[model samples]
Target: MKRFEGKTVLVTGGAQGIGAAMAKAFAAAGAGVVIGDIGDAAGQAVQAEIAALGGESLYLHLDVSSEADWQAAIGLTLEHRGRLDVLVNNAGLGPAPAPIEQCTVQAWDRIMAVNARGVFLGTRHAIAPMRAGGGGSIVNVSSIAALGLGALMEVAYAASKGAVRTLTKVIAAQYAREGIRCNSVHPGPIDGGMLHGVWSDPTKLERRLSRIPMGRLGRMDEVVAAVMFLASDESSYTTGTELTIDGGAAVQ
Candidate 1:
């Protein structure tokens, strides 16, 4: 359904996994896409694949953790395509499991930089360009970890994502009257390589499943769909809300 037809989208972490899927999905729906990732090789490859599918796109190196990078990327997208209709703040990294006491200051800072501060920087740059173009959508990729007890892994990651969740609300409320919509999607235990050791063993899986009524890990495509909805006019009435695309994990 050409929901994003003729729009221009910027997806951070668009090199692979959920971000890659979201980039292709947006392009398929007729939006010109810009893939922003530190992984230059993978980002270019994804852009090539999208082009093969008859989609318009460009690939750029974006370190979301850097404010200057965010500014330059948005500036380039607008300077090249005229505007950015959607901003998907998808770049992030998960730290190893640790209690509050065990989390090194450096480790916590790194996770917060990418997961939380990245969203802030992306949204900051997107608003003005979007305002100039009449308005746009901002979708931040948060984690279901923000909604519950800290799992066996990544305490710092969870905290960082939680910050993103709250940050989304503030932006949404502040921009609602300005025609800018901001939302966050929470994913549960996606089957990406990044999640491998976090839920190690069948027992760990079972414990994880027990909390989710759907009884299975979330797929990257599922997360992409939710992000797409939030990114497009399809969810125009939605703002400041946390949409959990976690297969009922947050329900329990």
Candidate 2:
């Protein structure tokens, strides 16, 4: 049987980038996938792509920062799939890099709401269903910024991801006996979406690339592979861990 033949997964911010890659990977692994994102059109497009590949999927409108949205999204998943086998808290935002002194209060709040609060709410609601279903895995998409790497100007973004990192560990420690597993994945300089804003300038892009020992940006598939491992039974013994897919940048 396929590894995830009887499983169901929900991936937030799944309309594009690494989240989208994860949705597709889980579906291909034989899981029913629910994709949540604020971009209705893009979300639906992903749903269609999955359908075309003979995968079952649902697209839901989700503003990850909102408690109501989290409740509704989880409800919809349970209603359709009966159980949630995995939850990928992949929804996050990286504001334009600005020094702490120049960052606005509003920007800070917005970043925290989506990057940090969203993970908290998603985890809060997922636990009960997961426990009810016997067990589940949560793979949070944090960033290299959380490790204090190359995030000098992104104070708020870095801090928000730090919250996610700690939150994953706490959840794992609290629920391990109950069969629930939680972990975080950190990627550096991925080639799309979030990285686009930071690497738009050719000079900056090259400069950033120079620091990675691998001498390149990470591919979405590389990160998705790590997430898939954490989500599957293959990682049954793993929890409360941070998996860095940063092309050796973290070592530097």
lDDT of each: 0.88, 0.93
Error of 2 at 20 (Å): 1.0
For all the candidates, what are their Cα RMSDs to the real structure?
1.5, 1.1
Per-residue lDDT tens digits of candidate 2, residues 1-252?
877898999999999988999999899989999999999999999999999999999999999999999999999999999999999999998756788888899999999999999999999999999999999999999988888775454889999999999999999999999999999999988888677776778898889888899989898999999999999999999999999998999997
Question: Residue 241 deviation, candidate 2, in Å?
Answer: 0.5
Q: Where in model 1 is the C-alpha error above 4 Å?
A: 151-153, 197-200
Tens digits of per-residue lDDT, candidate 1, 161-204, equal 89999999999999999999999998888877368675678887
- Model 2 per-residue lDDT at 89: 99
Using TM-score as the measure, which candidate wins?
2
Q: Please report how far candidate 2 places residue 150 from its true position, in Å.
A: 5.3
Candidate 2: where is the Cα deviation over 4 Å? 150-153
lDDT of 2 at 117: 97
